[model samples]
Target: MDIHYRNEPPQFDGANLQMHFIAEVDGEPLDCAITAEALEDHFGAQSALEGPLREAFQRGQTLIRAVCTRAIEQGAGPVVLHSGRFRSPDVPDVLH
Candidate 1:
């Protein structure tokens, strides 16, 4: 239920944006997610304004990984992490 930021002042440019989350249970890494965001805001929002969103994503990933890892680590079974793009169900078909 705790989150940690491995990097501060995360790069805004698509080239340097790297985000990672480590899920740990009983102090052991179980699952993790690594992702990068390449889009930019046109509203000229300050960097500080984006921290919460980035952090939240990272934290959520971490927690998910932790839960999955914990289950496997405790001899429940293996853990698999899947990665893919997400789209809103309401989006127009043209975008697909």
Candidate 2:
């Protein structure tokens, strides 16, 4: 699958309390999000506020995109990456 990520900034989805981003799979855009909890747990996000969350997302974008790409390849419709997903041994510690 040709998975390409958009360069757009992640948007805070207050309704779902997650940061949303876009990835194109073979020219089709897929909805993807990372939970605030995940940011806090793995990316050193001190709070759910946009600034901290965005900083955390920037630090962890590589792994986050990898995880999202894996999920999409596995046939997930809309990828929502949570804190627990990052706990896998194969997932790298990409905090900066």
Candidate 3:
């Protein structure tokens, strides 16, 4: 099963930044239990989440986080942060 994440920007409440996201399994959204981490804004993009959809975004973030955390923890092997390996079409993994 493949899970995809759709994010709706970060919601800043003057003091905190709330990241809202959705988890879709096979293109369908599923309600999930999640954990939240307050990250430092190294990029300095201080835009806040507002309007009628703000509350919904916040809830979505929680759901997505929970789903991801649970799934990753259940997987085997060590959890490593930032391998820094990104797929670049311009640069092939193997040189011909």
For all candidates, what are the clash counts?
0, 0, 2
The prediction achieving the highest lDDT against the true structure is: 2
lDDT of prediction 1: 0.36
Residues 1-96 of candidate 3: C-alpha lDDT, one tens digit per residue:
666556545433433334433456667664332112222121122233344234433544443344354454465112211112112232233411
| Clashing pairs for predicted structure model 1, backbone only | none
Cα RMSD to native, each candidate?
Answer: 9.6, 1.8, 10.2
Model 2 per-residue lDDT tens digits across residues 1-96: 999999999999878879999999999998899999999999899999989999999998988999888888889968999998888766665633
Residue pairs with backbone overlap in model 3: 33-66, 34-66
lDDT of each: 0.36, 0.90, 0.36
Better of 2 and 3 by TM-score: 2
Q: After TM-score superposition, what is the CA distance of residue 33 in candidate 1 from its true location, in Å?
A: 2.6
Q: After superposition, which runs of candidate 2 have C-alpha atoms over 4 Å from their true positions?
A: 93-96
**Can you write out model 1's per-residue Cα lDDT over 9-93, one digit (the tens) per residue?**
3333234343334444455554343233211121122342346436544444434344444444456433332222223343234
Clashes of 3: 2
RMSD of 1: 9.6
